[model samples]
Target: MSATSRVPALAPFRVRSFRFQWPADLATSWAFEMETLILGWYVLVETRSVLMLTVFASLLYIGTLLSPMFGVMGDRIGHRYVLSAMRAVYAALATTLMTLAFTGALNPVQVLAIAAVMGLVRPSDTGMRIALVGETMPAPQLMGAMSIQRTTQDSARIAGALTGAGLVATLGMGPAYSVVASLYAISVLLTFKTGGSRAAPNPGADTAGVSAGLRTASGERETAEAQPQARFPQTAVAAGDASARPSPWRDLKEGLAYVRTTPHLLAVMCLAFLFNLTAFPLFHGLLPYVVKEIYRTDQTGLGYLVASTAFGALLGAIALSARGGAIRPARMMIVSCVAWYAMLLAFAYTQHLASGIAVLMLVGFTQCLCMITMAAMLLRTTDVHFRGRVMGIRMLAVYGNLPGLLIAGPLIARFGYPITATLYCVIGLAFTLLIAVRWRSHLWRLEAPANTR
Candidate 1:
């Protein structure tokens, strides 16, 4: 068989709406990364405070705390609309920042305030966009679609980091800020063009009682793993009465309860949070500190460091996407996690610039692979109806980096960058070892062909 027959050429791209939406997603991701690079550099230059970096990083996720609620909102109101609306707001915020920069009025406090506000809108955009994948492609092609999605996202990060690094280095922050704002505006327009932009009928709003029960049963049972035992009494979907159905708050509670009770999902949730706490905070918050405090890199050097890691991420995502369904996510996930920790440990001891960037590149590769595996597992196993809410919870867990930043920043300030990095490396390794021991049986078996259930 030909490679095209064996691996498939990203079938999701055949859909016109998805074609547009995918690039839009890329642009948004690109803009976000660019902002991070520019903002981190700017903050460091202005205040010379690692604590401020921690506060800035933490603030970026403050809005993510409401991710579960936004997921519920997406299910009720439609993801496309939610995404488009938020993108519009994001565009405005970026424009405001750009204007401030151009007028020589931008300051750290102003950036922080805008970043916190922007954080509130970010969850809605991300959760809704991902959840919409179910609407865009057939069930069997979901893995390919998700892979392509991740590829674009990672590629954008690479591009954004380099572009931000170069721009800030050359023309300063104003022009870079303009580019970020423009990307958001483009995302807004693209998302508005996508179809299936209507609100989903509330499960209880229109269906008959018997049908509501059937829908609930099917949603719960459709995943590869089935747990028929009701750990929490599920509220019946009241098809006839939208007003009588459980409120969004209640739905959020049920979502939490569902994840807590579902072994696979609960495992995914815990590990995802652990990853954010250990690896990602290091990537976002600590790396900037390391570059500045330890190496004292200029803009070009800083850009190259971030870009090297991003390039590795881009390459990893591309490989995973091209292999498509041939790769077992669970096995890759385990290997990637182990490799990531090892690379991180090596990174801590490195003092040379070339060696540091190379180690960081490998670290990025493993981290990207691990994330793709986690995301694929979560998306494949989650019920369609609860996709938004589940993704919201997932994002919330990922934002565990906020607290992680709070902890790591102080540690970096007190113990210095190398010791702090070493401490996190040890913590991550120990955590990974525990997870491997406890979940060796089932976690690595996830997405494997031998066991369908």
Candidate 2:
């Protein structure tokens, strides 16, 4: 009877690692949001240019190309170890910024440089966190765990927006960054306590093999959805006979091979890029422009706008966590993707602050529904050995936002926010529909493997 029982929203905390990770992830996320808002506003104001602001935002993801390598290191060392090191980097960078601010040496150029340095490690932070959770949590609890994990970012956004804005306005930049650095230090300490910290990772212990040939190798096991149609003995034997640990290049290739062959992974990746390119560029990267230009507002007003969006996402995460596995994530992802773009189309035209805030909330809500499912489906279905690399590749999709931001700046400057946003939303809607039709068998069908819990 307990097999069918409803696991409560906080069930993931029953796992010891998650207890440490939830707070660690929360602190880290809070610092990240605060740093982003603070630095982003600094760039916009000091330079008095939206183009400079977008460039500053784009610099934050410059390390995205390196994510797969970071995954390789995590797999070779340990997710916990990599995460601890990354958070330390965060602390160090934030402290450096805080120092510069206090010494009156801080400027927009220095902020951009620090962001670039921080970007080299920051893009993989989320993937590493998810990989660690996937390593610790049971399959049945993954949906709830990820939903709760997502709230770390959602709630952090709300807190970051309010606190970042308040700190900057009241106490000024140096003191605000002191708080940011302190949070990063706390997160770094907490990250060191994850479950895997007790053991060195031995990835070779995983029966490494090409899970291609439309099947898992003989010694390799994966989720039912990724099971092969028929076993091919030779390939399985060659894979099983491998005596040496896979080279990072080999591991990377193996990770790539699976994604190349898996229809669902491919589909998820495309959508990931599409959203980053279109939806996220505005909601996430260009909020400053919207706050200043469209609404004619100050830092406090911008904080409210960002918090509104995050509040909606927080609500969505709670609802999805509460629902658990009762709903089909793949189905919901598609529906929400469509809904997100539609809501975005409305957001493009909202000239009033109240209306813009309302639409942004819906935009964030649908964004949560779409992204959480995309992540959960990937984690739930991916093999344990490939989780790190696969998620790394998923982070690569975030690189789309750089181009989206870069191009959006020019477009907005030339055509205006309304026209640029409308164009982006239309393109997103078209591609989402295309992806659905092309991968209908893999994603749209109710019986699709990706659709199953």
Candidate 3:
């Protein structure tokens, strides 16, 4: 049998770089899940306050505003180098936490302080990882690669959530953090194995796929008015190109100006910020509160609840990978976002553990489908050079989460879980529809360049 028939799932591994990158991404995400759960639980139990837990969680996203700078750094240096350095920092911080926990010096205050340091680099992780994949993989493999990449995170969430709860329960925080530290070290090692001493690949100009420049919803091709006489290099060949040697600020401005002119990209950012604001807070940081107060569960129950989403998302990522390019990302994202919000609405009213898990599974499933498609859509339409910076700007959308989480604490305290969650999900569903309507030509149309098959 040919390679495709022999092992379709492993096709992305044919590239030496991805072979290393995949494992590295997997380990890093696994460690992150473990750390988040362990620390979030500690903060909640110690302070006995949902407000403090939200503050701790919000602090973790402090680096999000600086994501564009991280992208610019990746564009100047290699993403692999940037990633290696970042993972190393992760290892170091994990070790510091382990030491504090072991010495009986670990407290919520100390945890928050350390988490602030970790936050300075964590939010940029996904953007850099995507930029690396786009640089290393061929265009034909982009969908499959993104799908597989998402699988690492989805699977990690399942593994990490369950394992972290177990480890902390049985062995206590110090020993549990030892595992997290070790995983970070493995991630750093694997990351160093990628990028292979060669300069990053240059994908040349924007693909003929995107070069059509403008398409009406009816599928007619037209030139856009703001379309420049020459398209910027899609994959910036930065290392040796004399012209690529401009100031980082100039590069940032160029990336911004280009994105501002692109209607689809602007729409994508808006949708991203919307989801981060209205949807993510319920599923992520705020879930701990929901578990303790609403579901009336301990940390193990919290683990199961969180893993339910991961398990569902893991299945969705696998399905997307198996289907490959058959799914158009932009179309899928809009549909899934609507479904995702609906699931959140279901989750808000859930009280029993079994029913809560069931609702969260659907919530997780749809959330993963929506986010992976959004990321793939961004990577697919954006050329390589700008991909990093574009993704970096995309990271800025995550800044919405900070405000969302901050708002959620008081709302939960005053208005209660069901009412606050209902408000959030309803708003998300309404805005998702508005976004689809607002950017119909760029996002809703089948033949739009943003939906390139």
What overall lDDT goes with each candidate model? 0.73, 0.85, 0.84
Model 3 backbone overlap count: 2
For candidate 3, the per-residue lDDT at 428 reads 82
Per residue, candidate 3 scores C-alpha lDDT tens digits across 1-453 of 657457776677888899899999999999999999999999999999999998999989989988888888887787898889999999999999999999999888999999999999999999999888887877667778888999899889989999999999999999999999999999999999987543244343244334444444576654323433222332234333545455677557666755776788888898999988988999899988988988888999989988999989988888888885788778898999999998999888998999989988998889888888888777777766577788899998888889999999999999998999899988888888888898898787888876776
Off by over 4 Å in 3: 1-5, 196-244
RMSD of each: 5.9, 5.6, 5.1
Worst 10 residues of 2 by lDDT: 198-207
Residue-level lDDT tens digits of model 1 in 196-233: 53223222211121122222423652211232222111
How close to the true structure is residue 52 of candidate 2, measured as C-alpha lDDT? 98
Rank order (by TM-score, best first): 3, 2, 1
What range of 10 consecutive residues in model 1 has the weakest lDDT sum?
203-212
* Predicted candidate 2 versus true structure: per-residue lDDT over 129-247, tens digit per residue: 98888888877888899999999999999999999999999999999999999999999899888864322322222222333332334555453235321122222334664333546
TM-score of each: 0.86, 0.90, 0.91
What's the lDDT for residue 323 in model 1? 73
Error of 1 at 12 (Å): 1.6
